[model samples]
Target: MKSKPSGTLSARHIVFFVIAAAAPLGFAVGSIPLAIGRGGIGTAAMFLVAGGFLALFAVGYVAMTRFVPNAGALFSYISAGLGRPLGIGVAFVAALAYALVSAGAVGPFSVFAEQMTQSLFGVTVPWPVWAIGGVVVMGILGQLNVELNMRVLGFFMIAEVTVLGVLGLAVTFQGGATGLSLAALSPSTIAQGQIGVVLLFVFAAFAGFEATALFREEAKHPVRTLRRATFGSIAVIALLQSFVAWSIVQAFGATVVDVANATPTEMFAIAARNYVGDWFANLITILVVCSWFASISAFHNATTRYLHALARDRVLPAVFARRSQRTNAPWVASLTHAIFTLVLIILCIVAGLDPYLDLFVLGSVPVAVSIPAMECLTAIAIISFFLKDRRGLSAWVTYVAPAISALALAVVVYLVLANMEFYTAQTGAINWILPGINLVVLGLGVSRALWMKYRSPRLYEGIGRYGLE
Candidate 1:
């Protein structure tokens, strides 16, 4: 028996997972204002430009879905095209990237959870209580069947998007601070003020899009479903980000940049109040908290599956491959990942780290760095895979598109590395140390793969091939 497919998932379900990971309302209220500050009035176009650039990467990515085994996307794709060693190496890096995202998210999730509670019921509970309690709930949820998890993610995703969409529409209908303007989308604004920085912030919003590929066995019509989910997530994220960004410009009208620069954090809260109502603003604030939790859940599910993929392939421990016969969820791996997440948050708390600056900012650095680096490698892998066997696919999908995407991603990798301190808002050993962790992890993975190649050749052959022995 192949023991394949607990096949109730679809492209729409995967789309829910991906968007939940991106956390549209959270990004809109939190990051977009800062993006506006750096990128200036042209922030709207920057979101679309980043999306278009990723679409180039997606062209080759989706094309190869038919060839690469769906055993955790990044590792399997790189391994199939490049080699088992690099694939194992990527598998480790992929795990590191996704696992750390929760590290960054949990701190803020706690803070907002506390805020939402106190706002609603005049109860000032401490953040640490919420922090540990939050992970506890997700840990239990992680062990359940994924459909249950996806439904929770879906409800939050819809609620946040609806709130943001209503705000945008309200701005359109009532006219904004200076009477809705086209200044945000003006073609002339494209080349203006630090466009590179705009691309940096916007691209980061699109980081978790690959969670879709990990669901292949569970997907109805795996290939087509993967393709649609892959492309569809990109389009929805880009449009939602761009539309709301442009609306913010309209909402504030004339002094948008001045206000964004002056008060980036509170700008969205203010917009929600003026355009809609104070109650709507409160709802948006509550949704921001939900948004961060949704992202944590989405990434938790992604990393658990990533761990299970590696375990079944013998890249890690066989113990992790244990699953629920009834729900088919990877129960053991899910618990393992949940435990890992809890320890990281607890460690940060014990060290007396500031959850916002030290925990959230520094914790997020690896995800911001490693994900782009992996994308570059995967794009290059696609080019290599196609060069050998075109398999009747067009040159564009096979090679041309990925080549351009790889080159573009190479620059993105450099830009992210160069600006680490600026965004992390830290100076000193912390900069190199953060990225250094990712490099060391990647190197260790490569070293392990080399050792496995000679010592355990059969298992090595199965790495990232869905345990093909």
Candidate 2:
């Protein structure tokens, strides 16, 4: 007989997977501040408020780990808890969000790569070339074994934390001319307005944490280990991010003005230079390029596995279920995702977009739409898990946690919409229509699900009742 089919990932793998997903740590802390800096002291307050909201969002998210244990993440959880149509909507948004984020990174990665190449070799390459390179790397790495990706992510995670800590401490000891100020935390500053802008940044900061649910089937102990890893990932990310935000305010002074004034794309280089000196600053820039790539790689790798699972279940095309002979990786899905990334890279470049700002906003918008929906669905899942069992003690995880998370995320979504103007400078038709545009995209996904249900009821129900391929 053929060897027994392989099982999902181990518990240790689950833990390492979450930890590796931390590559966005540097980008989140460094770049987000620049987005809100135009208003001066309001920058620090924005960071604090955004960070707080994210922490709240995490509370309910972590709780869902107990009920919905699957690596397909929001797509799987919501479908299982709610119905197929809703799940399909959520899955479409999730996939769009990941792809958008990766596409947006193309600009930043190219910019950083160009910066590094120029500094080291005294040569500059076209940004598109670097973008294409990123696509290749993402595809190759995504096709590797999950365990191997986690190991690579682990090293990047440690490097990210260590660099951030060292920089934070240096800033602490130096004591800037203005020093740190609590005024940055003032309600007057945070409440001054721009709810959409603030929420958008906050949501982006917490982007990939939901990927934790995607690791459940892979976990050694799916129920316990997945729950712990999911919650633990959220907690760890919050703490580390809070620390970094505090350091930024401390280093620049609570009222440090002119942050949005950083004309260069590598704004973080300024912070690194001020906090860690020139030699280290250069190193930090290089590390940032790696960090961005790692984020893309981690997402690319995990997402393809989800496609593989969905394919195996016959929800997606059977091609996605194919495994590489050597790596046992999901071959077709990984390449498909890569090709999509490359196309996005080309389109973004052709649009003459500012690599940094354009990428950040485009990458962020889909996530702002997808994540809250996931939270709401996850809440539904939690309730289902408890109702099906009638357990007395699960009130917190199943009911309370999901409720809080869903409520907080709903509020966050509202805030993001209200403050959209603060984010993109897009004016006229683009500004008026962009939000509607995203909704249209979401609506299309819903339509696709309906079509599938009608066209192939059996497969659709299999996806609905069982899960995606």
Candidate 3:
């Protein structure tokens, strides 16, 4: 018999997963101050709308932990519940989503790095330098075993949250000239167009929480631990963001819209000075670098594991399935992810993309696609998985939950396509290129499935019955 894989992960490892995922939360809080000042506090409604989708998505996601625990995530679910063709389709899109994330981050990271460097050293560097450095460092860290990386991630997350908490309190105490108010909490606020925009922001905030479940096979007590982490992360981060958004509104009141509109960068700086004086604000600037780094690390780890699962399934090369003898890690897959990330970073820099907008948009597309698509597939998977038994699962989780999730994803997909122009790249290719890439990937999957259907029907059938038979 084949030797069982070694180096299982434990629940304690979740702290690192959380840390790697924490950037979504931090970026939400940090970026919201600016969006609120510009777009109006009404944008806060996006939180509720997007958060609802997340809630629906989580139900099926957590449910899957008990049945199918693997890093391939969406791909794995589809293969087990649906068939090989669908599984391959998911694998293709999932990879596209992640690759886009690394590509998209390049731009913003450059801008963030440029600004921070200017602030501290009074020297300027090319935006690409900072972006490339982040890519490199994330790759190196990803090459290491998960346990050590988790500890480092934990430290960064603590710093990120602490800074935000400090800013929230300071804004509360100083009180904007107009004072805080509950006007933003009204239903009318969500009714506004800001809800649409805010939904995008909220989606961005919760981007990496799915990464937690991606660690299933590695984790001890995979089902229980993954569920707890997934649910706990969503609840904690969502509530915390609501509080932070409220604090921001309280700090600026009506002026929150104006500030977010005119001087976006100044929002954090102003809040920092008010909360802890100039020195602390400066320190927060440094923490931004660390925050971005931690986020990159998280993505690196997640994407690598995803590749590992694909490799194991024979979707990619078998070489990708190789593990590190020293640490019992997916060494080749990690290196591949690193190299892929590096190449994308370099390409974006060479292409002269704007760091902030470019990276944000790039990251947004896959995120917009991945979670919703994964959730929808998982939902459908639930229906199919239980088609034979249908006895143990709750109705909400089995049917209503996934249906609502599918509806939400449909809406999101519609909105993304409709507003593709809003987040398009400088090359003017996003409108065509991004969606085109996903389509091509799906086509590749179909082609492969057809070839297998002709060449190795038995293996193809094996893929179809992957987990659920």
Which one is best on TM-score? 1
Task: List lDDT for all candidates, in order.
Answer: 0.84, 0.64, 0.69
Instruction: Tell me the lDDT of model 3 at 99.
Output: 57
What does candidate 2 score on TM? 0.86
Regions more than 4 Å wrong, model 2 = 1-22, 25-30, 35-69, 179-189, 192-195, 260-267, 349-354, 357-360, 384-392, 451-456, 464-469
Q: In angstroms, give how far residue 418 of model 2 lies from its true place.
A: 1.7
Write model 2 residue lDDT over 108-180, tens digit each, in one string: 7778788888986789887778888888877888878877888887778778778877876787678753675
Candidate 3 local lDDT, residue 466: 32
Off by over 4 Å in 3: 1-12, 22-26, 37-39, 359-366, 425-429, 464-469
Models 1 onward score TM values of 0.96, 0.86, 0.90
The better-scoring model by lDDT among 1 and 2 is: 1
1-469 per-residue lDDT for model 3 (tens digits):
1113333665556745664565743475356865565346765555665666777877877776566655677776777678778778777777767656655655666677788889889999877778777777776777677887888888888777777777777777777546766667666877654444565556667776777767766676667777777776776667667667777677666666777667766677776676669998787778777777777777777777777777776667879889888876788987887777777667666787656666566556656655565666766776676667655788788677877887787777666565556555334766766666667777897678767778878766655333341
Clashes (backbone N, CA, C under 3 Å), per candidate, total 0, 10, 11
Model 1, span 1-469: residue lDDT tens:
1234447888899999999999888878778998888878788987787788788999989877777746589888888888877877778888988888875788888887788889888999888887788788888888888899989999999998898889999999998777877777775786886766776688878989977889887887777888899999999999898889999999888788889999987898899889888999888878998999899888888888888988887778889988989878888888887888788778887988877777777888887888988999999999888897798889999888999989988998898888777778888988889888877888888888899899999988767766333
Q: What TM-score does structure 3 among the candidates reach? A: 0.90
Ordered by TM-score, highest first, the candidates read 1, 3, 2
**Count of clashing pairs, candidate 3:** 11
The better candidate by TM-score, 1 or 2, is 1
